[model samples]
Target: MTSATRPYGTRERRRSIGSQGESRGGGEERTGPAASEGQEATAILERARAAVDPELRAAVDSLPRRMRRVARYHFGWEHADGTPAAENAGKAIRPALVLAAATALGGPAARAAAVRAAAAVELVHNFTLLHDDVMDRDTTRRHRATAWTVFGDADAILAGDALQARALGMLAEDPHPAAAAAAARLAACVVELCEGQGTDTALEKRAPAEVTLDEVLVMAEAKTGALIGCACAVGALYAGAAPEDVDALDAFGREAGLAFQLIDDVIGIWGDPGHTGKPAGADLAARKKSLPVAAALASGTPAAGELAELYARPHVPEDPDDLDRTALAVERAGGRAWAQDQAADRMSRAMDELARAIPDPESAGGLLSLAEFVTRRST
Candidate 1:
C-alpha cells in the first residue's frame, strides 16, 4: 500500500506541531521543538480535564440522589460501593476540544468563558455512552462493569436522560451571550445523534451485503461528528467569534470526529482487550455494522462475499477459530485499508477546516495537536 493507503499501524505520519509546557496559561514558554505530538496532546488534555472536571462534577451532582450516584460511578468518580476510587475516567476529549477551540480563537481567558460549554459537551458525551452501552448490550466500560449492568437498565437509562437534560440545562442557564444559540445547537446535535443511532440499529437488522459505505459514513458523522462539531462551535460562539469562523471550527471538529470514529472502529476489531477495555473481536462478535465492517461488506471483492457469509451465520460465532476467521475476512476484504485511508483523509481535511478558521497555522497548533492525538493514538 502507498503511504496514504497504508493501515494505521504501518507507519507514523508527521502532520502537526507539539507543545512543551504543562499550562496553556502564562508560564515559562519554550518556543523551539519540544515533546512528541502525542505527549503534548496528552498534556493538553490533562490540563483541560483538570480545568473542566469541577464544573462537570457540579453539574452531575445537581441530579437526584439515585441518578447522581449512578452518574458519579459512571464517571469513575466513585465505586459501586459508594466509596471514592482512584479509577480511570473518560479521556475528556470532547471537553478538551471545546477548550482548545476557545483558546485557539481567543486566548486562555476564552477557555474560562467557555467552561460551561465544555462541561455541557462532556455531560452529553457521557449521556450517550450510558445509553449506548445499554443499546449495544455492552457489559463493560473503562475496565469495569457498565452502569446498565450494575445499576439495572431502567436506572442506567434514566441516568443518561438526566445527564442529557443537565447538559442542555447548563447551556440554557449560562449567562454568556451565546448561551441561547449554544443550547439550540446542542439540542439539534442530540437529535442528529439519535437519528444516527436509529440508523445504526436499523443497519444491524439488515443483511451486511445491503449496507453501503455512504450510509455507514453518514451514520458515523451524525452519531459521532455532530456533538464534537457542536462542542467546537459552542466554544467559538462563547469567544464571540464570527459566524463564519464558528462554522469553520465546526467543520474542523466534524472531520476530526469522523476520523476518530473510523480509528475507533479499527480498534474495536483489532485492539488489545486489556488496553481497549473490551473483549477481542467484540464488535465482530456483536456483528456491529461498524465502519470497517461496512467498508469490507461493500468492497465487492471476493473476500467481501466470504465475510458476508460469516456474518450471515445463524448466531454470533463462539469458537475462537470462527471469530478469528471473521476478523481475517474483514482485513482481506480491504475494510481495514479503506478505513485507514478515510481516517487520514478526514484528518487532512480537518486541518484544512482549521486553517479556514485560524489563518495562522501556529495559532491552530493546539487544536491540530489534539486532532492528531485523536486520529493517531494507539488506544
Candidate 2:
C-alpha cells in the first residue's frame, strides 16, 4: 500500500489508535497505568538480562583466546589490559523481547524454555554492532573505543563472524523441540539483515534526491526489524505456540523495531552527546542517509534544497553551527515531523498486533509496557 493509504498515515486514524488504551465507558485515560506498568516491564527486562548474562559470557569465553579477548572488551567485560571492568554492556533489549514474548505466552516456565533463544538473539545483536561500528568508522561505542578501533579491523570482523556463527550454533544444538525451526527462522533473518545493510550502504553512495521514503523504510525493516521480529518469533516457537500467534508476535516486534530505529535516527542527529554517547548532529556530519535526511530530501521543500546543497559539498561540515543549521533545515523540510509521526504509527500498529497475539490486553502488560518503552523518548 502507498504511504498515504497506510493505517498510520492519516491524522484521524492516528488519533483513533492513540486512544486504544482508554476506557470506552468513562473515557478514563490509560496512560498512567501504561507508564507504571512500563517500569514494571523494564524491571522484568533487567531480570531476564541477569538470567542470560552468565550464559552470554560463557559463549564469548568459548571462542579462541584472541577472539575472546576482543569480544570481551567489546562487551565491556574487560579492559584493554585484559582486566575485568565494571562498565555496562548493551541494553539487552533483543533478548529481553524474547523472554518477554515467551513469558507473555507461557509464563515463567516458558522463559526458561526460551533462554537459549534469548542468548542466541543477544549474540546476533552484538555481532551486528561489531560489524556496524567498523562499517560506519565509529570510534566509540558504549562510551569507549569500538573494537575495530582498539583491535585491528580484521579481528573485529572475525569476532563478529564468530558471534554470528555461535548464535546459529546455539540454536542448532538446542534440545528444544522447536530448535530446528527457530534456527531456520533466525538464519533467514540474518540474510535479511545483510540485505538491509547492503541497501543502506548503497543509499549512502547515491545523491539524496535519488532515494525514496519507501526505500528507506524497507531498509529499516530489514536492518533493525528482521532480527527483532526473529527474537519474538523464537520465543513463541520455543513455547510451541500456534503459527498464527508466532506470526503476530513477529509482526509486533517488527513494528516496534521500526519505531525504535526512527527515534534512534532522530537521536543520531540531534540528541545530547552526554546522553546519546555520540557527537551532536553525528548523522548529519557523516552525511549518513538516515530516515530524517531521506524524508527531508524527498519533501521537495526549499529547506530540502538547501539541505541537499549543504550535503553535496565535498567535505562534511566541521563547524558545529553548520551542522546545527543542516539539522534545522531537515526539520523545517518536514523530516522530523514525518519521522515522529511514523514512529507513533508504528507503535500503534505494534500494539494492535500484540493484542491479536495475546487476546487479553490486560494479560499482555509486560509486552504493552515494553512496546511503550521502545517508542518513548525517555526510558
User: Top model by lDDT, which number?
Assistant: 1
Q: List the residue pairs that clash in candidate 2.
A: none
Cα lDDT of model 2 by residue, 1-379, tens digit: 1133222222343433223212233434335544565567679779888989988998999999999999999999999889998676877888888888888888888889898889999999899889988997889998999999999899999999999999999888888898899999998999899899889889889887788989999999999999888898888887788999999999989998998888788777766566557666878887888998899999989999999998897534546478878988999999887887888778777767776778676667676666666655332
For each candidate, give its TM-score against the true structure: 0.90, 0.90
Q: What's the lDDT of the predicted structure labeled candidate 2?
A: 0.81
Model 1: residue 51 alpha-carbon error in angstroms: 0.4
List the candidate 1 regions with Cα displacement exceeding 4 Å.
1-35, 314-318
TM-score between candidate 2 and the true structure: 0.90
lDDT of 1 by residue, 1-379 (tens): 1223332221245332111111233332323222376678989899999999999999998998999999999999999988998678888888898998889898878889888889999999899999988997888899989999989999999999999999999988898888898889889999999998889889889988788889999999999999888888988888789999999999989988998898788878876576567676888988888999999998889999998998988434557687789889999999887887888778777777777788776778788788877875554
Q: Going through the candidates in order, what is the number of backbone clashes in each?
A: 0, 0
In candidate 2, stretches whose alpha carbon ends up further than 4 angstroms from where it belongs are 1-38, 314-318
Q: Provide the lowest-lDDT 10-residue window in model 2.
A: 1-10
